[model samples]
Target: MLEILFEDDYYVAVNKPNGLLVHRTRIAEEKKEFALQILRDQLGYHLFTVHRLDRGTSGVLLFAKSSKVATLTVKAFEERQMEKLYYAIVRGYTPPEGTIDNPVKPDKDHKHKAPQDAITHYKQLGTVELAIPVGRYQTARYSLVQVVPETGRMHQIRKHFAHLRHYIVGDKRHGDWRHNKMFFDELQSPFLLLHAAMLGFEHPVTKQYMEVHAPVPQNMARLCTQFGWKDVLPAAVFPPASEAL
Candidate 1:
C-alpha cells in the first residue's frame, strides 16, 4: 500500500515506492501497478495527478481531488511555486555541498532523445565506506546526498549527477556500469538509489503553505544500517525549519 502523507477535501499526497510508475507511460509499460490507480482504489474516489515522481525514484507525489484544484496546481508547478526535494545514495564521497547550475537540455548524444533545461542543487548528507570484496583491494566508498531542484526536468537529477561525474549508485541508464554491476552483484539491489523525499507547495484551495516529508524506503534504510550508518545520517523525517509547514 502507498504511504499516505497528506490528504484532505480537495487533494492527496503520497510517498510512492521505488520501481513503481506514477502513471501509465509508453516507455515503461504498466507491468506492475501505478500510484494513481492504487490511490484511487485505496481512497475509493478518483484523483488527478498534479505532479509526478520518477519510476525509479520513490517519495512524495501529490494529487488533486477536484479538477478545479488540479488546474491551478498545474499552473503553480509551471510557474515554479511548488518545490520538490530529493535524496539519493551515490557511489563515492562527494563534496560538502554543491549546486549543479548547468542547464539541462536534450541529450543529443543519447539515442532515446530525452528533453532538457534541468537545474538542481545537492548537499552531502553523510558517508558510508563499505569496502565489499568485489575482487581485490579495490573496495568502494559511497556518499548519500540530498537534492533539491529548482526546475523540474526529465531525468534532471540523474542527468546532473552524471554530468558531475559522480553518478547515482543504481541508475542503469546514466550511471557507470562497473559500479552498478558491483553493487547489483554484491549488494543485491534491484532499483536505483535515488528517492523523492519531500514536496513543498501552497494549497490551491486553502492557499495554505505546506511541506510534506517522506521517509527513506526500506532498501535505502537497509543499506544505511548495513554500512553502520543508521545514526550517522541526518534526520530525514524532520526536515529543516525553513521547510517546515
Candidate 2:
C-alpha cells in the first residue's frame, strides 16, 4: 500500500516508493502494478497525476481528484510556480553550494534533438569518508546534497550530477559502475540514492500556500547512518510553515 502524505477534497499526495511506476507506459509493458492504480484502488476513486517521479525516486507525489484541479496544478508546474526539493547521495564531496545551469537533451531516444535549458541549485548538507577502497583511492567519499530544480527536464538531476563528475550513488545509467558495485557489495544497497524530499505549492482551489514533505526512507537513512550522517539528515526535509515563520 502507498503512504498518503496529504489529501483533501480536490488533491492527494503520497510518499511513492522507489521502483514503482506512477502509471503504465509502453516501455514498462511487463509491469503488473503501478502507484496510480494502487492509490486509486486504495482510495476507491479515480485520480489524475499532476507530475511524475522517476521509478528510482521515492517521495512526495501529488495527484488531483478532478480534471479541473489537475489542469490547474499542471499549469502551476509549467509556469514554475511549484517548488520541488530532492535529496541525493552522490559519489565524492560536492561544493558547499552551487547551481548547475546546463542544457540537457529532451530524451535519450532523440539524442540529436535540441537541448533544453535545465537549472538545478544544490547545497551540501554533509559529507562522509568510508574505508572501502574504490577506483584509485584507498577510501571512498560521498556527499549528501539538497537539490532545488528551477527548471524540469528529463533526468535533469542525474545528468547534471554526472556532468559534474559527482555521480549519484546507485545511478546505473549515469553513475560510476565501480562505485555502484561498492555500495551493493559493501552496504547491500542497490537502489538509487536520489529522493524527492519535498514539494511546495499553492492550493489550486483555495489559493493557500502549502508545503508537504516525506521523511527520508529507511534504506537511505541506513546508508546515512553507516556514513555517520545520522545527525545531518533531518527528520523532516521541510519544516512546518509555522516553524519557518
Among all candidates shown, the one with the greatest lDDT: 2
lDDT of 1 at 164: 87
Tell me the lDDT of model 2 at 18: 81
What TM value does model 1 have? 0.87
TM-score of each: 0.87, 0.94
For residues 1-245, what per-residue lDDT tens digits would candidate 1 score against the true structure? 78898888987888888888888876668376788889889989989998887788888889998899999999999888988878788877899999887766664556476455667888887887766754353678788888889898778899899888888988988887777888888888777888787788878777889888887777777776676556645566533331222
lDDT of 1 at 18: 86
lDDT scores in order? 0.80, 0.89
Report the poorest 10 consecutive residues by lDDT, candidate 2: 236-245
Structure candidate 1, residue pairs in collision? 104-116, 104-117, 104-118, 105-116, 105-117
Q: Per-residue error at 3 for model 1, in Å?
A: 1.7
On TM-score, the candidate that comes out on top is 2
Error of 2 at 17 (Å): 0.8
